[model samples]
Target: MGKITISQKGSRTIYRVNRRIVCYRDGHKYCVGKPSSGSTNIEFDALSENIAHERCIEICERRIYADMKYQNPVAYNAHKVLNALA
Candidate 1:
């Protein structure tokens, strides 16, 4: 069974895979975290849909940021998340 799904609402793309939720809102530069449990707030782990795997690109950037340095964390993280989809 597939746990992933994509939806559109007024030019927004919503992604849901199991307990994780990712939303690319209109005019938003990056992925913003929203409460998948539908309570109040969401945790950091929910973001990126878990691209933190050892072979994932997210891990690459994270390591680079630690070694070299990162200029923009928001855009950097977003790029990693979106890149995994690509």
Candidate 2:
């Protein structure tokens, strides 16, 4: 049920979810696309590849949670409450 993938794109390594580019590596730096409407991207220079991948996953999950909150506020709050109880 997961749709994430990592692959090389010429000199840069790219991370994607469902074919949409989410993060990338260029030279010695890893870059993750912001989950907002801003035009800026996050870059990590000292992180390992695995860490960068995890960051990408975190950002993607945040975006999904934001969408869920916007589309169904009641369900989102219920889910949050359930998680908090656990």
Candidate 3:
């Protein structure tokens, strides 16, 4: 199981998704460390307001579910929904 962490960078607070020992940042929401099939940097910027925090939560939750996709069908389907939302 991987852990998601929240840390402060100067005055800005950033989120990190640690999956398989790889640390992924908020602005860079792609996981290049695991599942090496496809990894693309996801942009999480909002002009209206700071949507980074929300995106980080969504992404991390989706990933956590995705990691356990095989064992639990419910969580897998829920992961699909979250993936769609994200």
Give the per-residue lDDT of model 1 (tens digit) for 1-86. 44877766554566766654455543332343343556443454444434322223344445666544366778777776887999
lDDT tens string, model 3, 4-75? 666564434544455222224444353223333144333221211134434555677766666688679887
TM-score of each: 0.30, 0.48, 0.31
Per-residue accuracy of model 2 over 51-86 as CA lDDT, tens digit each: 556765666667778989999999999989999999
Q: After superposition, how far is residue 73 of candidate 3 from its true place, in Å?
A: 4.7
Q: Which residue runs does candidate 3 get wrong by more than 4 Å?
A: 1-50, 71-86
Clashes in model 1: which pairs? none
For model 3, the local distance difference test gives 0.48
lDDT of each: 0.51, 0.58, 0.48
**lDDT ranking, high to low:** 2, 1, 3
The best candidate by TM-score is 2
